[model samples]
Target: MSQSDADAIDEGVLADARAEASVAPVPKGSLWRDRNFLTMWSGQALSQFGAQITELAIPVLAVLLLDATEFEVGVLTAANVAAFLLIGLPAGAWIDRMRKRHVMIWADGVRALALATLPLLWWAGALQMWHVFAVALVMGIATVFFDVSYQSIIPSLVRPGQIAEANGKLQSTYELANIAGPGLGGWLIGVLTAPFAILATVGTYLASLVALMLTRDHEERRAPEDHAPILREIGEGLRFVFTERLLRRIVGYTATGNFFNTLATTLLPIFLLRDLGLSPASMGLIFSLGAIGGFVGAIATPHIVRRIGEARAIPISAIAMSVGAALLPVAALVPALAFPLLVAQSFTASFTVLLYNITQVTFRQRITPPRLLGRMNASVRFVVWGVMPLAALLSGALGTWFGVVPTLWIAAGGELLACLFVVLAPFWTMRELPDAHSASR
Candidate 1:
C-alpha cells in the first residue's frame, strides 16, 4: 500500500499493456482501415458532436428562454463541470481498476438517459432552471468517467509512435463538432426549441454506445488482484504526475490555461447575444469560424511541431489565447466591425487551442506508461479542468458587478498573465518526447 510497494506492483501490471500492444499492433494500413479503430473513432466522433450540441444549446437556453443573468449563466456553466472538481480524483482512481472500454460504454448509456430529461420536462411545461442545472451536473459526472477511461484506452490501441497521428485524427472531432454541432443546434433552436435540439445529442450517445460495444479492445482484461487502498492508488497517480519532470510542468502550465480559457468561454456567448445583438443561429455561425480554424490547426499540428517544436507551440498558443481575447473588447468599441471582429477572435483562439491540445495530448500519452494512464490523465484533468468552475463563477461575478465588457477585459488580462507560466516553467528547455520503451525501463 505504500508508494514504493505500489510502484513495484504497477511495474508488472503495465507489462500487460505493452505485451498487448506487441501482440496486436496497430494496422500497417491506414488507421481508418483498421476495423476496431474505425469503430472506436465513429463512436467517439458521434459522442463528441453530441456533447458539442449542449455547449451551445444549453447556454443559449438559459440566456434566451430563462433570461438568466450573467451570474446565473456562470452557475449554469459551472454546474456542468462541477463534477470534475467534486469527483474527478476518485473517479480516476476507480476507473484504473476496471477495463476502460466497459467504463466508456456504460458512461455513454448513463449520459444519454440523463440528457433526455431537459426536453421531456420542457414538453410537459415543467422545465425549470434547476432541471437544466441538474441534468448538466449529472451529465458532467458521466463525462468525467468517460473521458478518463477514453484517454486511458487510446494508448493500448496503437503503437507508442503512432500516438500523435491517432490523437490528431481524434482531435478532428473537435473541429467537426464545433462547426456542425453548434451551427445545427443554433438553427434548431431557431426553428425548433433549444430543448428539442438536445434530443439529437441523446441519439448521438446511443450511437456511440453501440459502436463501442462492437469494437474489440486489444488490452487484456485486468486479472483479479489484491488491490491497493484507493487513497494510496490516488496518491501514486498524483505523485507520478507532479514529480515527473516533463508532466509536472505541463500540468502546471495547462492548469493556468484552463482557468483563463474558462473566462473566454464563459463570457463569449453572453457578449454576442446581449451587447452585439446577435441571434443564436448567427452566433453559432460565427462560432463555426473558430471550428474551421480548429480544423486547420489539427491538420497543421504535425508540421508545426516538426517546424517550431512543442515547447514553442504550447506557449505560442497560450499567448495567442491572451491576444485573441483582448481583441474582442477592442472590436466591440467599433459598431461596424463587431461581427467580423468576433469571428476573427473565435478563429484565432480556436486555432491556437488545437495546436496546444494535439501536441500536449500526444506528448502526455507518449511519456506515460500504459498502466498509469488513467490516474495520470485524471490528475491532469483534475488540476486543469478543475479550474473551470471557479473561473466561470468569477467571470459571472465580474460580469454582474462591472458588466460584460469590463469583465471580458479583466479576463483578457488574466489570460495574458497566464502565458508567463510556460516562459517560467521547465518545458521551454525540452523539445522531443522520450520513447515508450523508456517507460518500462
Candidate 2:
C-alpha cells in the first residue's frame, strides 16, 4: 500500500485506542492490586532472570568448550535472533487470531524443552556445534512469539494511562534480572558448566509457564470469520507502523542501534576473554554492575518524562546512549582500564536505553488500537530485530578480517550516527504525545 492509503487507514483506526479511555473499565487502586497483572509480572520476572543465564552461558559454552572460532561464534549468536527476521510478521498475524496467554504458555514450554536438550547432550558426550545452533534457533523462534504476545498482553491488563507505569514496572524487574541473573549465571557456569546452567533456565521457564497458565487475559479474540487474508493483515500492520512518522523514526534509530550493538557484542567474548584475559566470573560481575544503570533508568523514566515531556525524552535519551556507546572502543585503547571502562559503558548505555524504550513503547501501546496491538508490536520487532542476525554475521566477518578492536571502533561510530535519526526529527519541538483522538481528527 502507498503512504497516502496508509494515512487514510490511520485516520479510521485511531479512535482513543477505540475509545479505550472512555469505554474500558478503569480498575480501582494501584496496578499492584490486580491479580492478572501480578501473575504476568511474576512469571516474566522468572523467565527474564533465566534468560540471562543462557545469554552468558551459551557463548561461554561455544568459546571455552566447543573451541569455536570468531565466525563460528557469530553464527551461533546469529542463530538465536535469526527467527525474528524469518517468522516475525506471520507470527503476529497468527497470534492475533488466538489467545495471547496461550501463546506465551506454549512459547515458554518450547524454550524450556529446547534448553533441556543441551545438558542431556552434554552428559551423553554428544554435544556438538550443530546441536547448539539448532537449540538456539528453536528458542529464538519461540521467543519471537512470546515477546510479541507479551507486549500486546499489557494493554488488556491495565488502563491506557497506566501503560507507562506498567512498562516501567516490567522493565524494572527485567533490569533487576539483568543485575542478578548474569552473576548467578556466570557462577553457575563456573560450578555447573554452561550446559548444566541451562537446566536452571529450563526450571525458570517452567515456573513462568505455571504462572501464565493461572493469569487471566482480557484479549478480544477474533473469530475465524473476522480474519482477513494473512498477507493483507501483515500489510496492514506494516503500514500502521511506517505511516506514523514518529514510529518510523523510532524504528530507524532502534534498527541502526541494534545493528551496530550486535556487531560489537558478537565478538566481545573473544576480546574480553582471550585478549584481556577476564574470567567468566569477572565478566558476569561487570555485566551486573552495569545493569544497575538500567534498573535506575526504569525507575527514573517516569520522573524524567514528566519533567522533560515524553516527546523530547526520545531524542535526548538517544543522544545520551550514543555517548555511552563511545566508551566501547575507548576500552580497547587502554587495556589496563578496559574492565572499568566496559562496566561504565554498559551502565550508561543501559540506562539511556531503558529511558528511550519505556517512553517509545508506551507511546506505541497507547496510540494503537487493541485489535492491531499484536501485529504492530511484531512489525516493529521485525524491523528493529531483523538487523541483528546480519550484524552478527557481519561482525564475525569483520572481526576475522579487520580484527575485533577495529570492528568495535566501527560499531561505536555507527551507533553514534544512529542518534541523528531521532535528533534530526521534530521530536525536539514537541513536549507531549498527540492524543489518539486528536491524531485521528
Candidate 2 ranges beyond 4 A from true positions: 1-43, 153-172, 213-221, 306-309, 365-371, 433-441
Model 2 TM-score? Answer: 0.85
Residues 25-73, model 1: lDDT tens digits? 6554467667888888888888877787777888888888778899888
Q: Model 2 over residues 1-441: C-alpha lDDT tens digits? A: 000101111221233334554555454447888787888888888999999989999898888888888888889879998998999779867887888889999999999999999989988999999999999999999988887677567666776755555665776687578799889888998898888888878999999999998887677889889888999888888998988888788889988988988898898888878878888888888889987887687689999999999999999988888777778778878989999999998888778887887777767767777778657866877888888899999998998899888998898899889889999988898898775555332
Q: lDDT of each structure?
A: 0.75, 0.81
What is the lDDT for 293 in model 1?
80
Where's the lowest-lDDT run of ten residues in candidate 2? 1-10
lDDT of 2 at 56: 94
